[model samples]
Target: MSINLSSFTPYDLRAKLGEQLNEEVAQAIGYAYAKVTKAKSVCVGGDIRLSSESLKNALAIGLSQAGCRVIDLGLTGTEEMYFATVHYKLDGGIQVTASHNPKNYNGMKFVAKNATPIGRENGLEEIRVLAENILNNYQTSLTNQNLGPIEKHSCLEHYIKHLFTFIDLTKLRPMRLLMNAGNGAAGHVIDAIEQHFQNHDIPIDLIKINNHPDGNFPKGVPNPLLHDCREETSHAVIDHQCDLGIAWDGDFDRCFFFDSKGLFIEGYFIVGLLAEAFLSHDPKQTILHDPRLTWNTIDLVKEAGGKAFPSKTGHAFIKNDMRQRDAVYGGEMSAHHYFRDFFYCDSGMVPWLLVIELLSTKQQNLHNLLKGRIALFPNPGEINFIIEEKEKAIAEVENFFRDQDEKAINIEYFDGLNVEFKNWRFNLRCSNTEALVRLNIETRADPQLLEDKLTLLKCLLNKWIKK
Candidate 1:
């Protein structure tokens, strides 16, 4: 009965599998989840992590012990679990996934009925306390009266059908897509989609690499956001002369894109691209963007006749805002895109499908489609610093900018300290789990200004940041 409390984050659990998480801890959390939510039926699924299956099974046992029927989706992405929870009208659902963490790490993500998030503010704290107590002295429900049933179900077919609703297969031009799954859960969905494409006679060719779902992560963990991790997909894009290079994380909740030239497009640009795509036809739709990177998204969204608004970062916040405001789409600079059609949950699969559809509808390659937008708004992307005192560092940065031009700098506290100037802007935010602050800067077609400002910020914060 060993469990590390550090595994619990603001919204979900993510920690080293052996040291911080195991079968017993997962079970306790599962039982607590069932009891606290008073769920009569709970749906469970897992990613390809070596530990996720066992943890999911243990969680199922706990839910069943609490007299909840468990629908086990043998292996699926996080979005699929969200879909199932709402599609079946179940009381709650949980997906066992660490989501872009290292291979040795594993965790679980939770959603209440109708696929609403259950974050720390709402239910996680109660669940954590109850789980810890349960682990202190757990009981085996030998009595059938206390034990519920577990059954396996496949949500893949319906999930893919839902994905296709975003785009018309017949309209897609003949093109090759280099998809790098990075040996994670995404490979399964990619394979399934490929088969569907064949059956539908779609001419699109999927050039898949690192496509096997390996628990050991032979090609490395599935996070393409890292520059080092992006080489495989980028190079493949060039080598295969692909129309688009798409990459997904361990659990496939967020997706990254590369142009045909094998250059990785910053997530900021993709946000704008997607916002414009959605708004071009669906005019006046509300588009939500994170403050960390907003200039481009706001510009594109507004130009497309859509209303653009800012939402705090993270899935919990974005989903909640989307539901509240009835936003059609919400995107973060981190590549997580949420859709209203998908029960306001973020889906890695949906974004790319929409993007490919956009490419087809516009009759342009991915490079041509995004190059103008990238040039119009140049950015250094999000830069993270390993900081000791994150709040102090953020304050120093904010104050220094204000002091430099008190009349010129306008600051807004949305997700972070967003400081705006005449021609350039930046956001400084602290990481919730680590002593790190992320900085994002963008300039209006001023690469030199972007460089000069980035260099200045780097020099200003250098002393306070650790290597």
Candidate 2:
């Protein structure tokens, strides 16, 4: 079937999945990925979406036609593909997932050998072109090719075993945990992990809410990042008197957390906490963090006797940097946590394990673990504004702050405009994935200063929007 070809997108092709679009996109992606990597064997998997199975089959057919073997990992998370690709030493892998997107939306994430992401600059564009060509009937290069056979495989056991490599089983303390899978792909994985914990007598109580994997998404789209979507998990934590609350999106590539106090810990703080956790284990370890917000991560990394380096915010960039630096750990403020042992790929599952280990070893509550850090560096989190003239707005922010060179201290564009001033700093960057500007501001242990500066920046943003 020849699709419009223009309908598919870069990174992941996300759109309503009910129509024939899902299969078409999958086939195009499989063909494009196979052609690009020229892999002898490729692993493919999908999340709990209703269309995932059919889409995975269509993708496998395309892969087979491209003369590539397909190892089908039935009903798995995105990280499973990454794990299987590297563990099996396959040529390539593809995961059919839209991450945290809506129920109607579905997409795909592709990785080459060693679980390397295929982003825009690094082969994603080429894949996009090939997929478009195939969809539009211009791709006659590999038609009627000898098909490669499909084989079923399961990495659940191995993946669960590998997860324990980050923690000491003896140190795992008995504590109640509240988990909200949001009816996503994580339920089964969580079940497997809990089974292991129970078998090993790890002493952890797993209290589940919305644990069942339902494609209908009875609660919502499984995006815990949205404040409204987080209520169930928060309420469960308070009502159950759980020590920790963890939530995952569809496909489970990212994870969010809530303290026993029912307070949601922003992903920014988790990065710092995880950095500290990983660094304490390996003093002088190199840590990779996104440039969007840096103060907390840098401070924690330094305090832990490790080195901190900033990368442009995104998985591909962070993963590449992690591999290059051989960093012990890498984390984005957006809940994507990466590890050195995990093929430098991000996993929503690993962060919580490490955090649990941290909690057990330190014997501190989740809230206690974060309270001091939150107080030390008060931030208002990231604010996104829809402004068509993003470049103009960013330039305006830079110009507005340019006159204070003496007080500005330092200015850098590691990812976007990051202007540092005395006691307070803000990074105003235009989102690469959308037509919007994102602002993050932080001040030294002073909530008032943080709010005051945030208000000033909002004034600037509002002023520019009016123009």
Candidate 3:
């Protein structure tokens, strides 16, 4: 009997361990990626999951069976595969990771040349169909000649060097930093970066918490967005008196930060901070931001003499938009920071480095630097609710506010439903990765108005969810 992979999405194939995802399914997906991308040489990597290695092995075997040379970057994060693909000039790449999902779940992230993402509108659907076709038509027609060779390579040094390019080592302040790896794939990379800094006498003291690469995830999955997941990092920053705190998700693709006072800064504000940082160095640079939270980023960019463009959410959309606009920087409130210098792909490591440089050059504490901005743009961050009828919920929210006693309210559907009033606005959209409907709201220095609207929206969201 042929295997079925119903868990495959446009961006990746994810499933619980030994369930929908197994050796056969992973192999088939690899074969599909090789066939669809016409990749002769490919790079494969995986996180510190127990089942990840087996999946990686299956993927390598499938690539080999398709007569393609596979470069194995053992126990690597998602971005490493991206870096390997473009740096080695390979045809494509795959990284095995569920990315902050439960421990038993594992998945794969795919990309074409130059680390370009293969999403739904791009090549992911094609890859999914081909993978399913291969699975449903499975047979024992395999032979030795069909299998190629799997070579092992390490690009850690190159990746570390690339990260160094984002900041001036000499200008980097000798400050203690609290780093929480969440026992995912970020520890090794963090170690590498720290080593280089130490060797160069950079005097950047890195206080790492949960730094070991443990698939067991004793401290729970490494999603810093979760209020609970950030405690350790935040406490460490406070106890150690660190200048800054950094945390990453399971695959280290998304990075989150806490100020010197151990206050977790929302990623929404980081987008504006980064925009200002880049614009400070070179004015009038184009910055691409997601439409979810626009006013702060737009205002910051414009004030710095930079152009701000809003793109739909998601890495593929952001990267494509960045390329089209030749944007120097792109950021999502979800902690995904993309750089034009880094092949327009998001990087968790780069964001922190850039932020450090901003602090050092400006001679301001992390908290002080962002204090005014946070006060100016108070956001409650993203609130997600599980609603089966996502479309209806969105429409109801839109209709409820559309008839309000207000004029000049703007509405945009760049990614989802964004209803804008002059003093406050909210964006309601179904999550691409989950069944939840996410709502992000911001106000023009009006805390009470923001809270009032948020409470009103929550009530509406609960009403719709119950229905």
Best by lDDT: 3
Instruction: State the local distance difference test value for candidate 3.
Output: 0.88
Error of 3 at 180 (Å): 0.5
Q: lDDT per prediction?
A: 0.87, 0.86, 0.88
Which 10-residue window of candidate 2 scores lowest in summed lDDT? Answer: 2-11
Task: Please provide, for model 2 over 1-467, each residue's C-alpha lDDT reduced to its tens digit, 9 standing for 90 to 100.
Answer: 55554434445566667443567767877888888778889999999888888999999988998989889999999999999998899998889887787777777788888999887777878777787777677834546578899999999999999998878889988899998999999998899999999899889999998888888888888988788988889999999999999999998999999999999999999999998887776888999988878899998898889999998787778888898899988988888999988889989999999889999989999898889989988887788898888999888888888865356888878788999977988888887656789998888999998888888899889766644
Worst 10 residues of 3 by lDDT: 137-146
lDDT of 1 by residue, 1-467 (tens): 54446678888988886646889888878888988889899899999988888999999998998899999998888999999998788998999998888777899899999999999988998898888766665442222357898999988888888888888788887889999888888888999999999998889899999888888888778888888999988889999989999999998999999999999999888888888877877888999999997888888887889999899888999999999999998999899999999999999999888888888888998789878988888998889888989889888877787777345557877788988888998888989878888999999999999999899999877889665
lDDT-sorted candidate list, best first: 3, 1, 2
Residue pair clashes in candidate 1: none
Q: Tens digit of lDDT per residue, candidate 3, span 75-157?
A: 89888888999999998899999998888899988888899888877778887777777767644333347677899999999
TM-score per prediction, in order, is 0.96, 0.95, 0.97
Error of 3 at 314 (Å): 1.0
Instruction: lDDT for model 2, please.
Output: 0.86
TM-score of 1: 0.96
| Candidates sorted on TM-score, descending | 3, 1, 2
Q: What is the C-alpha RMSD of each candidate to the true structure, in Å?
A: 1.9, 2.1, 1.6
